[model samples]
Target: MNHEFMDALNEIVESKGIDKDILIDTIEQALLTAYKKNFGQAQNVEVEFNRESGDIKVYSTRQVVDESDYYDSFLEIELTEARKIDPAYEIGDIIRNEVTPRDFGRIAAQTAKQVVVQRLREAEREIVYNEFIEKESELVDGEISRATPNVVYVDLGRIEGIMTRNEKIAGEIYKEGQRIKVYVVEVRKTSKGPQIIVSRSHPGLVKRLFELEVPEIEQGIVQIKSIAREAGSRTKMAVKSIDEKIDPIGACVGQKGIRVKHIVDELGDEKIDIIKYSDDPAEFISEALSPSKVVKVEVNEEEKSALVVVPDYQLSLAIGKDGQNARLAAKLTNWKIDIKSESQYEEELANGTLYAKEEKIEEEIVEDFEADEAVDLEEVAEFEAEFAENEEIEE
Candidate 1:
């Protein structure tokens, strides 16, 4: 070891962001292990490094003992032999002896190199872990570097992020070097490094994109109440205004629909329905089912449910393709929605069974009451007949 070697270590510390002292300490430990392996494993050894010259020195320790009690000759030295080195040597006192191997410098250098490399790798892993843990649930842009059938690797500048197949949009495909925005769903610290889990299908991605594009949302003028997304297909969002002057829907849409247009483009032209949020469940449910005209809205406030009636011809439209529109509407309103056509609602009213739930309970109670009334009537008739017959017999 020499000053030149210490300079090289300083350069490594500057480039790798590892503390110089820690590296030196680690190298010392590695040299200690190599010394024991090459010399005597059972002997007590101490290793030290000179800070100025980077020179390593090794020592072997032995306990002083009386001549009669010394059985392990290497681990115990009789005081008679110890007194030659020092007159203060007494029984049970410890002593150190220089045992540095003549050719140990070359061995220590080779051993230190391997240990430093391993420690550098560990330090890098720790750095990556600390960097990404703070970004959980945040949005980031990354380029697709590689893809397997089950996972896609994205180069996020400093580290690679993983996107599983389930995290990807249903209908979208990716190629090498494709730039895309992803939501940081999770950050895991493993033996290798920070495993950043990115997603293109998380509903949060849509919300974050809106925040980036619309200043009103970030400023609290307009608040996004809810979002329901079927990635690669369509999404419905409900927004409301904290400030009365700000039209939440218009603010999100921007002038001539430019704001929403940018988001749609990011999602590969995926459709988005921006609707005004309402305090009233009926009004909100009605708005949530957009692009389909709702004739009337009747709500059961206690149940947080709504009965939506639309034009007879609009029933299919309200239901949408495979009932996606109504499903998304239900999610957006946070309510159970029962959509009906005008004709169907009228038929349910005439039949006296609109809400299947409450109607069943009402029918049960009515049946019990009618049954009691019939039983009383039968008993009264029997008593009246018996009283008349008894009067005739007495007469």
Candidate 2:
């Protein structure tokens, strides 16, 4: 039992990464507690332990007094008897006698067991906390173990973390036993344990994933200036290559579309538009709303607004389904955008109208006048026709 106890302590120290000396100190303290609980409240009782051999010793101290003062009291010990234990002991001198605690083995065993468990738990907690604290805002690989209604339990080898429903991207599906990467949103130490909060919808996840997958981004050859994503739907990122020879968009796409495809697959086939960044607002906005072929871009730099004119056929495409593309573009550039068809814009300008205002008013007035003139003309024409018919009948 003694050898087994020492082996167990050695294993705990190695696995839990706790110092051997610290564990020994903790064990000694626990033994003291157990001794106090079992033994009576005697003054100046001391406990010591030899960690190497697992040897324990307990003792108590008493003050020596003259035979006349010696009584049945706990402190009043006869000097003659005290001197035999310690020949140099005199009146008022203190003597320490070896004492054996009852059931010392059973009590010590229980106390050591508790201390080991507690120390192991504390060591595990410290290890987990340190492991994840530096990983905050980074990406980690995990596998889906189970999916509940409100959360996903992901197995990250040694630990399990939860990805809440709010952290999941819309239209992104998480399946059982699927290997995935998630963003470390938070690492909190709670009373229950270390709570690791992960996410799939965070924008930072996409950026970090790209950094991991794309060498250009990792090496600082390509800089990701801005990124805007409607998670699980579409993402617009503005990238600029520092080296003129390197094509930022092509580098991100990778050979045979391997790099970006991996990211897309991870994100559940979310559409990604990589636009070359431009310092000029007009050029950047034009490129951002790609495949739409903007006819013109009138930017109000002070208000940070842009009036974009596209062909009639490309209007819907430029604005996207339910205006998603245009909205994301505006959000990406931090500009309010108003997209218009080329014909619609030209028609307004030709008629000396600003934004369909004068044209609508003029059309309303013309319709009213035309209605009144039609009524007068119909009455006059009826009277003339009746007079002509009466003259023909009389003749």
Candidate 3:
């Protein structure tokens, strides 16, 4: 029994990564509790446990007095009686009586065992919590262990994490036993276990994945300027290269579509456009609304707005399906884009249209300036004519 107990304690220490000395201290506490409960509470008791040998000892202390008041482990031995036991004994001294393991019964052992197990589990939880607390927003690779309509269970070795429906890329599929990488959106402790929230639809998921796949991004040679994603459908990213030698778009797209292809595969074949970032809003907006040739871009810097003109034939393509393309492009470029056909834009320009009323704004401004100048000239002329009339009257 003693050998089995020692083996269990060693196993717990190794498996839970708990310090043996702390375990020994906790065991002594448990034994002390059990001794008080089983025997009596009034006795001054101390408990000790040897971590190496798993030996438990209990000591009961009492004050020495007269022999007439002798009691079990609490005898008040007289001065003469104590001198007989030890020649140099003193009055009111505390004498300790050691209790053997045999003194504790089955009930005491069972109670102490429960206490040890509970304390060990608590310690293990603290250790695991501390280990993963700082890794909340990191990326992790996990295998799909189970899949449901609303959530997927991913096995992250020591813990299994959950990827919920909203967190998943739209229309993206998952299969059991398939290994997939995910972003750790959140880490929380629950009554059951550590609840790790994973995501496939987050914008940061793409950013971090690119950071992993693209050496340029990892080395800071290429940086993601902005990303606008319609998950599982299409994603547009604006990337800028720090060095002139590296093409940010080409680095992201790799040789013959290898780099982007890997990302596409992970995203369930979601189309991604890796457009090179430009400082000029016109150029950047034109690139963002790609695959369609842009004839002109008129930017309104004050309002953060732009007018993009494409050929009449490319209008539909530039606007995209259900206006998603233009909407996402606007979000990515931080501009309110008004995409129009070249013919339509030219017609509006010819008609001289503003947000309201088509009028030649320059002609109106020139008329107002000329009118003010004429009014000042008329005032000067009237003053001269009045002074000339006064001189003629005086003559």
Candidate 4:
């Protein structure tokens, strides 16, 4: 029985990658539980396991007491009897006496097996969780393993991650064994194990894809300021360059739009608009509403809003199908955009509404500047007069 137990212990340690000392500790606990269950009594017993010979020992502890007070055999022992058993046994000393159970090898082995299995499973879950926690919000490629109508599981090498219907790109299809890139939206530790939530529709996925495709973006030569995505339909991105020499748009677009084309292909032919990011709201709003020429842009700094006026012929193009272009531009710029045709703007202008509002705003700005300048002149004049009076007093 000892030989068989040794072999099983070695096999479990090697196969499960569990530590030997932890296995010993676990088996000791299992034996204690089994001894109590089978013996039909709860006693103050402790189990000791020797790894070298796979030997097991059980010991029971009792407090020494006077002969008349000895009532419980498991908890107390007569002092006179303890003295005979060991001459140095004291009254308050915790004496450990061996009480190994008879024919306990089989029961102990069965109980240890159950515990080892449970411990091994918990350890494996912890390992997997630790490995994936650092990968949250990262992009990784994996193959589809299993799928239902609403959920698809991807084989992520030591673990499987799931992508839900909402995380999937609209109109995109998923097939078993097909490989695709995914964004790790979250890594959560749950009762079952690590639940890695992945996605293909997040705007972050677009930014990460660009980082992977464009070396300039990867090296931080160009930064993607914002992204607006309709997932499998269209996307708008604004980019800027830290180095004046490197053209952010040209680098992202690549030669003949090859760089962007790869991203578009990966997104299932989603239309992409790569616009140059500008600090000026007028220039930025105009650039965001691309593929259509803009006649003028009026910005309200206080409200963070813009009035974009385009030619009447370009209004439909600027707004696009169902106002998608304008909507996406608004999202990307984080500004309230009111796009108008030249004729519409002209009507507003003639009714004195647009012009009057503009004059009021401009007048407020001019008044603020004048008030600040007047305050500055007063302080300067006072400082000079004080300096002149001090020089006369010194003389």
Candidate 5:
């Protein structure tokens, strides 16, 4: 290595954020290994580097010992010979002799080049991994670089993120070079480098988009309680407000529906329903089945299930095509919902099944109470007539 090489090393240190000392130590180790392999491993040698000139040198070291104690000349030098080189040498002192071969510079050059390149690649991978691991479960924008049948690759600047078929929105077309937003689902460290798993179908993507568009949500005035998504079809989000003055649904919807419109456009026109969150499961389930008016909701808290009633005309809307609305509502509330229309509920009531038996028992109790009230009114009227006749006689 030379001064020009040192200049390049400085550039690597500055650009890659790798410590210069670490690189130097790594290169020195590599050079030592090369020397041992080419020369002899039996030699006790240490490699050193010149910081100023970037010169590398290998030194053969031996321990000085008395002639009586010296058994191996390779590892130990006699005190008389050590003293000839340096009179200050003691029996236990170490002596170093330069053993750098004439052609060793060429070998050192090749070894250092390989070591630096490999180290630089490793440092870059570490840098990318650390940078993206922090971004898991967050939103990022990238351009579509390419697509295969099973995967779509998004160029995320320094690294590429893979979106598997399962992570893609159904029926959505991805064109090369198209700018898109995605949610980071996972960051994994692999032998190749960091693998970023991104998704458009994840419900978190919708939540993040809302956070970006709605200031109220980001400011903590309005908070999203839950989200259920069908990706390319529809999404249901439940939101609540910490400040009573702020309407969470209104805040997410924005004035003139502009905030949600932007989000919808970004999502390829997927429909979004922003509903107010309620602690009451019945009320929440009713709100979750949006665009369909619910007549009543009966909840079984222990079972985490509910029976929902809507107008006969709204039955199809409540169930949606392939029961998507009802399915999303169930997912959003974490409840199993059975939706029935008014006519179907009445039929069930007539058959005395499901809630019908309870309804009939309640009716019988109401009738008994009404009969007792009627007899009480009759007896009071009879007493009033008797008092009138006595007052007439007194007059």
Candidate 6:
């Protein structure tokens, strides 16, 4: 090592963010090991480095003992010889002598090279791990690097993130070099390097996309209450507005639906329903089953379950194909939902198999009566009169 080597070392310290003192200490230790391997191991030695000059040196140490007490020449020196080197040397004092080999600089260079390279690799891995750990549960843009039968690898700048089969959007084909957005599901450290698990099917990806598109959501004027998704098919999101003037659904949908359209395009045209969140569970459940009109929602709060009634014609739409719509709605509202057509609900009411809330039934009857133009006036009047009489009789 020399002054020129110190300059290069300084550059590495600055560029790699490595501690200078620690690197020097590690180099010294490496040199010590090299010295023992090359030279005889019979000598007790310590290695040192000159910070200013970047010079490496080795010293052999021996403890002074009386000639009669000295049993090992490697560990103990006769007091007479110690005193010859330094007249004032006393018994039990340690004597150090420079034993740097004539060609030790070459050996020191090789040892330092190995140590620096190893440290650099370790530091880079740590940097990458820490950089990505903070990004877990966040969105990232990457290019598809390659794909296996069960995994897709994405180039996320400094590292490749793995997206497993379960995390991929169904029916969507990925190609190499395709630019896409992914959700960072988790970050873990492994022996090879940092393992980043990213996802395209996570519901959080939808939520994050909304946050990116809707200024109201990012600014806290609108809050996303919940999201339920069947990736590549449909998703239901409930949102509420903190400011009454700002409509949460409109803000998320953007003017002319441009904002949501961009998100849909990004998601390969997955359908998304942006519904207004409600404090009332019944109202929220009704909104969650969107595009399929809900006639009524009867909730059992204690059981976290709901019985939903839809028009006969809207029953299939409410339940969706294979019950997907109803399943997503239940997940969105955290309630178990039982869907029934209006006629089925009426049949259950008559059979006394389903218990309906009294207030909800009264509200439905009143609503029916108010829409007299849609139904026979005499029938509405008779039903209202009968309901009132039943209530009075019960009271």
CA-only RMSD, every prediction: 12.3, 19.5, 14.6, 9.4, 17.1, 14.7
Model 3, runs deviating above 4 Å: 1-11, 14-16, 31-46, 57-108, 115-139, 295-312, 334-353, 356-395
- Tens digit of per-residue lDDT, candidate 6, span 207-267: 9999999899999999999999999999999999999999899999999999999999999
Candidate 1 lDDT over 157-204, as tens digits, reads 889999999898887888999998999999998877788999998899
Candidate 5 lDDT, 1-395, residue by residue in tens: 79998899889989999988989999999999999999979568999988778999999999999999989988999999999999999989999999899999999999999989999999999999999999999999999999888899999999999999999998899999999999999999999889999999999999999999999889988999999999899999999999999988899988999999999999889999989899999999999999899999999998799999999999999999999999999999999999999999988878778676557899999899887754777778999999999999999
Predicted candidate 4 versus true structure: per-residue lDDT over 1-395, tens digit per residue = 38677888788788878898887887888889889888766678888877877788888888998787779988888898899889998776667888887888777777877877888888799888888888888899999999888999999988988999999998999999999999999999898888999999988899999999999999999999999989999999999999999999999989999999999999999999999999999999999999889999999899899899999999999999999999999999999999999999999888977667768999999899878744777788999999999999999
Q: What ranking of all candidate models by lDDT puts the best one first?
A: 5, 6, 1, 4, 2, 3
Flag regions of model 6 displaced more than 4 Å.
Answer: 40-43, 64-73, 77-81, 90-92, 355-395
Q: What clash count goes with each model?
A: 0, 0, 6, 0, 0, 0
TM-score to true structure, per model: 0.82, 0.72, 0.68, 0.82, 0.81, 0.82
Q: How much is the lDDT of residue 340 in candidate 3?
A: 90
Error of 6 at 368 (Å): 47
Cα deviation of 319, candidate 3, in Å: 3.0
RMSD of 2: 19.5
lDDT of each: 0.90, 0.86, 0.82, 0.89, 0.93, 0.93
Model 4: weakest 10-residue lDDT segment is 369-378
lDDT of 5 at 282: 93
| Pairs that collide, model 3 | 65-76, 65-77, 65-78, 66-77, 66-78, 67-78
- As for lDDT, the candidate ahead, 3 or 6, is 6
lDDT of 3 by residue, 29-119 (tens): 7778777777777457787665566566777766776666666545455668667778877878876678645757464457658867887
